[model samples]
Target: MRIFDVAEITRNIKEMCIEANYSLTEDMVSVIREAAKNEESPLGRRILNQLDENMKIAGEDQVPICQDTGMAVIFMDIGQEVHWEGGFLEDAIQEGVRQGYQEGFLRKSVVGDPFGRVNTGDNTPAVIHYQIVPGDSVRITVAPKGFGSENMSRIFMLKPADGVEGVKNAVISAVKDAGPNACPPVVVGVGIGGTFEKCALLAKRALTRPVDQRSGIASIRELEQELLEKINRTGIGPGGLGGTTTALAVNIETYPTHIAGLPVAVNMCCHVNRHAVRVL
Candidate 1:
């Protein structure tokens, strides 16, 4: 089996942290541009243009697109054939986040405690998820999740009979409840059919998928499109100024579940939607 160095992982994570915060992905950029053109409200179109300019400026200056640089959330897919060397994988990832935030001048938003909260100083102890697969290569994804939209996320337990219509209403209700606070023109990630925790995770994973990419499953793809249309019709608009461009995309990820229960989660992400991935 091939041996991989934790230092290598650390190095990559550092760069990813900086890059994701500063650079809006190409797919996201293209989608926003299209949204601007299609936005029904004059104010909505103008807001989208301003957002585009903001992205351009951030990239050119190599500065964070948002002041809330966000808590570091990492996802790793490690090949079973590979062995780790050099240091503990968990520590290495946190070190990478620390160095990235310090050196890149990204804000440190993570806290040490939930109730009696204080800054973690370096944004240490990243929220990391690991998965094992068949190959020798490792894939790492860094997604900085700001709290604005995160705070608006919700999970619902629906009866098995609730089905598609229930899922639709729950999603719409969550967005409506969020109003402008979660940041309009948001990306909605819907996780369905899994257990309580798994469903929440499915929603988070959904956000990592490219906004333009639809699920391979035909029925799921149709549902995504339907949800997108209905969410935009809410008229939350750009920056919540009142318009037809409330949400940019709706993504759904599902898993097999028990016969008696249906769990659904809605994870909201603002237009920034910052995420970066690397494989080694």
Candidate 2:
């Protein structure tokens, strides 16, 4: 069995939080660059160009790409064969976030209470999703999700009879309603099947998938391509002014579900879909 220290987890998480806020993965950057080059509308092209420059500045200056900074969302894939040493794992994860926000000088956006509106001071107690998989390595993904696009996300509880067409319509309607609000040229993460909550998780997880890649499932890949085409055709443009490059990519994830239920969720993310991955 592989022996892992909780302190190491803290150190890595801290660095990841800072890194993710500073820059996006190469796949994401390339896609936006390609979009700007191919964009038909002059205004859309300009907006995409501005976006690229802003990202460049953020990385060069070691600053956040967007002011929101976002609440840290951690996905931990822990191996069953691994054994933890030192302090509690959960506390270490939270400490990592706390230290990252404090040391990184990132804006603190998380609140301790929903209605009270008190700041957490440090962005502690990140929304962590843990999964046990084969092997003895830990895979960590830190995704700082800003609220602008997240607020525009939607979930649909359709009948199994509603089928694929219904799913397409629901996602399209959500984007139409979102319009410029989701911070156009968004990457859409879609989850099909599973329970209500599971579907939402799936949608959020889908966003972490590399933007340049498609779902391995044949039907899902086709759906992803079709959705990307349809969304761009909406004329929402880059800054939502008007154009053909409304969305950068459409990623879909699926899971088995009950016969009576067809749960679908759309998790919207803006141009700065910030995330960083590391394995230990």
- What TM-score fits each model? 0.99, 0.99
**Per-residue lDDT for 162-194 in model 1, tens only?**
989999999999999988998789999999987
What is the C-alpha lDDT profile of model 2 across 1-280, one tens digit per residue?
9999999999999999999998889999999999999999999999999999999999788888998889999999999999999989999999999999889989899999999989989977699999999999999999999999999999999999999999999999998888999998999999999999999999999999999999999999999999999999999999899999999999999999998999999999998988999999
Worst 10 residues of 1 by lDDT: 116-125
Error of 2 at 91 (Å): 0.5
Poorly placed runs, candidate 2 (over 4 Å)? none
Residue pairs in candidate 2 whose N, alpha carbon or C atoms collide under 3 angstroms: none
Off by over 4 Å in 1: none
RMSD of each candidate relative to the true structure? 0.8, 0.7
lDDT of 2: 0.94
Evaluate model 1: give its lDDT: 0.93
